[model samples]
Target: METIFGLDLPTWWFLVVGGVFTGYAILDGFDLGAGALHLFFKKEESRRIALNAIGPVWDGNEVWLVIGGGALFAGFPVVYATVFSAFYELFMLFLVLLIFRAISIEFRSKEPMAWWRQLWDVSYSVSSIMLALSLGLVLGNIIQGLPIDDQFIYRGTVGDFFNPFSILMAITTLSLFMMHGAIYLVMKTENRLYAKLTVLVKNTTIFFVLMFALSTVYTLLYLPHMVERFKEVPMMFFFPVLTILAVANITRQITKRKYRFAFFSSAFVTAMLMALVAVGLFPNIVLSTIDPQFHIDIHNGSSTDKSLKIMLTFAVIGVPLVGLYTGFVFWTFRGKVKLDETSY
Candidate 1:
């Protein structure tokens, strides 16, 4: 492949999106996972502990969302606009849920009143569930494709958003996050709560495994055309298999009370799964059933050569700065969370 400005445009866009989304998953994955665990915390102190585990870093973790969204808008505006318009109602509902959850996280501990704190705790957990579900549904719908007219616009309604594949994806996302959160708690906390998290992981790992298997089967069933491709490229199976091994390692380590390595292993598993999906779906940024031409191939959906070249130049200068800032924040907040009576 010929390169422009030391990089191919379409490949660069794919890399950008893949990098941004992976960052979002690893960073915000814990935030959502922690929030999902809110209802599990029975005592006020426990709830505060859960909240504090994510407190110092949650806000910064959310910056990945902004970066991911901004990258999509700038790098692939058409895809962004089309998908957003297609799922306008669903997107709005998702945003509202996310906002409520974000607000509740900050405002929930403002008072010592049992009712007020409990109410926000409920909101946080519910909102986290909805957010994860919505994100999974969006992925499912995109992978499944939608009706579009000659104008290259989506011609689907809100009801079309909840198909079997999409729902399966929602469950997969929910399960994945729950497991991810549990791994995080193991890493960051000790005492009864940590032991409880270990027990929770033991209890939930089977369900996570089952849900993953079901989602894989459902996706393969729905998208049978890709089966042949996978068959031809047998090496592609390595990532999924590695993910399984990683999960197994995480379980084994947790059983041995190796919290630190367990968390890192879980994160590695997620990254491998993501890489597998990206490689599996290469060349086709968006698949379409209505017409193959309707599919948004990376080559076709990319910006002009001039635009990409210019963007490449800016990326070279700016991406390093983003990396530096992200690193600094993570380093500054590297310790386990401590929730005192007066701490926020």
Candidate 2:
């Protein structure tokens, strides 16, 4: 096993893949959240404003998903193949929804007719909600362990993915994204919409907090293995503590009308939550419910050392470029969204 800075190649690749997905969650989360709340804005102008708030960067944010998929396939082809095979229908539905979401965003403002716009609005909101829920369902199953046999083949049916824990995780994911999106909208609007979002932000915050609490309790009680790593390494407790503080600070910053800070807090919460998941699933990319010997770990799931080394070189150069481009886009579009003739 080739080591870089003491950690093995697969572990480095694990962090890289995890980091890319975390970026996707933080970047695209707000826009999806905004889309989920679209129907709540009854007025056409309000809907347009909400859409325009995310208009400039929504597609750019999705680039992270592409990067994540590529990284997953590059680093852990076995896990990718098995997981995708296991969730084939769900992933296909997710892809269809993503396409519908992109189409709704692009076609929503093309016509002046109320029926046309209303149709796309419903499509957009429903797709966003489903996208978030689907992501949660996948994450939940991953954490709960899949029924993988010794050959790394998933033995579970599609129906098996819809357990109560996955459903709870799905809703919790939606609530967190809603909170994140509401804060972003609050930061990007003025006057009426801002005021409306202030009220909505509080509600979303409450919604996320309640859901998070329930998820934590459920994990502690039923999913004991998820917390085993933290118990083994007490210092890893800091991540969860920081996650709690970040969640707490979101409401604090919102109450103080520091929306920029609140938005940052929300992003931090997303990152921390993903980090917690990574920590819990360390070494094992996919756990097996069938038997302990069936786990697909970083070592067994990864590519050759030489391949990882070559890809790491590319990733080192390429990831920074992507980050720079993302930063530039946000910096260029940094301000309250003003509706113009060109607005979405």
Best TM-score among the predictions, by candidate number: 2
Q: Candidate 1 has what TM-score?
A: 0.93
Q: Which regions of candidate 1 fall more than 4 Å away from where they truly are?
A: 1-7
Instruction: Name the regions of candidate 2 deviating beyond 4 angstroms.
Output: none
Candidate 1 local lDDT, 172-265, one digit each (tens): 8788778888777766777888778787776556667788889888767777654555677887777778888998897788778777787788
Q: Per-residue alpha-carbon lDDT of model 2 for 1-344, expressed as tens digits?
A: 77989998999999999999999999999989999999989888899999999999999999999999999999999999999999999999999999999999999989989999999999999999999999999999999999999889989899999999999999999999999999999888898988999999999999999999999999999988889899999999999999999999998998899999999999999999999999898878899999989999999999999999999998888888999999999999999988999898
Q: Each prediction's TM-score against the native?
A: 0.93, 0.99
Task: Give candidate 1's whole-model lDDT.
Answer: 0.77
lDDT of each: 0.77, 0.94
Name the top lDDT candidate.
Answer: 2
Number of clashing residue pairs, candidate 2 = 0
Pick out the ten consecutive residues of candidate 2 with the lowest summed lDDT. Answer: 276-285
Clashing pairs in 2: none
